[model samples]
Target: MRLLQTQITPFVNNFLHIDVREQPFLFCPLHGKPSFHAHPELELVFILEGFGKRIIGNQVTYYETGDMVFIGSGVPHIWLSDPAYYKQDSTLRSKVIVTYINPKVFESMFIHIKELDGVKEMINQAAKGINIFGDT
Candidate 1:
């Protein structure tokens, strides 16, 4: 017979979702360009309505209406309206909401379901961010 030692894992150790006290919103002027910034919380970005290019890590993607994305913590990213795709006075440039979430929240939610195993796997494979291109 082999003896096995039991080890206790701390509750929510190394994992804890960030508590966002308020909604997420980021805006830049039509001609303004912002630098990439990182946060401790995960981010969920949904384009209410707009056409712009998102630069995450080394990936640059263009998006239209209904587009959405999920950005992981500490990932450097930025969105800039493609000047070739819009006018300087257009409202489309400032319509993206980047919602933040803590990674621990995801891990905790993922632990509760067996069916979500696949989803959990997918999340692990996701890059710094995942982009959802909307139907044109």
Candidate 2:
């Protein structure tokens, strides 16, 4: 497997010099305002605890412990918990582990291949949104 250079966002810079590291690590406090933002790199998130909903473009889904979500590059998204769950002394925010990679990684594989037509189609559909239940 080829080693891909992952972009290190400022949000992750305070903890470590992730820019030079092979794999970057980002940690955000579980509680915060509800908002969505677009990323330039693909994102993988693993929820360790708490409850919330992840909004990917127009698709919104509830997530809890053990929930894992893979969001491709440039797809705007956010996670928010119900007000009922957010209270003093409550750990309502989800603990997430996120990994980001360049979209070129996929483009490098499918951007110029005729045999990868199916993958090309999936990439197109991904531009809309994709949610796979972990139980499957």
Candidate 3:
């Protein structure tokens, strides 16, 4: 498997890189602002509260509370909140639980365990992006 170098961004380099070597996964709870960006890691996001549009690669779709999405590495994406959420006086809130995972860790498991072939195939499909629904 090929691994791409991680893209450096202010949100990643400054905020997300806290002791990543000790823990390859990053769990973040985000509210309000969203960043339009891409990085070299798989991302799983659960929309706890919000209503907006989600853009992944060239696909655009509307999303709301309880929505979940998985984005591939190097795929540009953003969860843009509804216009009202951007207003200073607006009381609306956008909350999301995001988890960033290093593919190398999974790759290692795939290489060592033959039983993980199914999981490996799933991850391979994720490279092109996958939208899982119904109790994923």
Candidate 4:
């Protein structure tokens, strides 16, 4: 399969990054904030493949393909994939889609858009982090 890591790049004209790392899940700087850290930017993360534990704010849970979560500004988070993905000769890979949104964008959108009440409510609740599941 073609490597997904090569597709990662800074979003043009936006405060965003398409962080798609393929392997060595631990301490992979390309994963950027791999440890517990918080930023003012809101973030939405989706797992296309791999298995791991995800820690966001006060919630800790095992995650796998199709796992998606939304994190609000200043909410600390981290993605710790299984150790197998880091072993030499291992073929395991991680395909994740992480989209970061500047708080300023959210502020402006919610300020004048009454249609975003549902979205606003979700983001507000996201301060504690939100995990989405059950598409089947």
| lDDT ranking, best first | 4, 3, 2, 1
Q: Please provide, for model 4 over 1-136, each residue's C-alpha lDDT reduced to its tens digit, 9 standing for 90 to 100.
A: 1112212224423556556655456333644535666767787888888888877777889889888888888877677888788788888878877787766666787889999989988889999998888783
Residue 124's lDDT in candidate 4: 92
lDDT of 2 by residue, 1-136 (tens): 1222334344443332212211111222222234466655666666656566777777877877677676766777776665556566654444555655555555677758889888667656766556556573
Error of 1 at 40 (Å): 3.0
- Best lDDT among the predictions, by candidate number: 4
Clashes of 2: 0
Tell me the tens digit of each residue's lDDT in model 1 across 85-127: 3555544334655555556656787778789898676566555
- The better candidate by lDDT, 1 or 3, is 3
lDDT of each: 0.55, 0.56, 0.63, 0.72
Query: Which residue runs does candidate 2 get wrong by more than 4 Å?
Result: 1-33, 91-93, 111-121
Please identify model 3 stretches exceeding 4 Å from their true place.
1-33
Clashes of 1: 2
For each candidate in turn, give its C-alpha RMSD to the true structure in angstroms: 12.0, 8.9, 7.8, 6.7
> Candidate 4, which segments miss by more than 4 Å at Cα?
1-12, 15-17, 26-33
Q: What is the lDDT of candidate 2?
A: 0.56
The CA lDDT at 87 in model 4 is 82
Q: For residues 65-134, could you state the per-residue lDDT of candidate 3 as single tens digits?
A: 7787877768877666777776777777666676676665556777789999987777677765677788
Q: Which stretches of candidate 1 lie over 4 Å from their true place?
A: 1-33, 84-93, 133-136
As a TM-score, model 2 comes out at 0.60
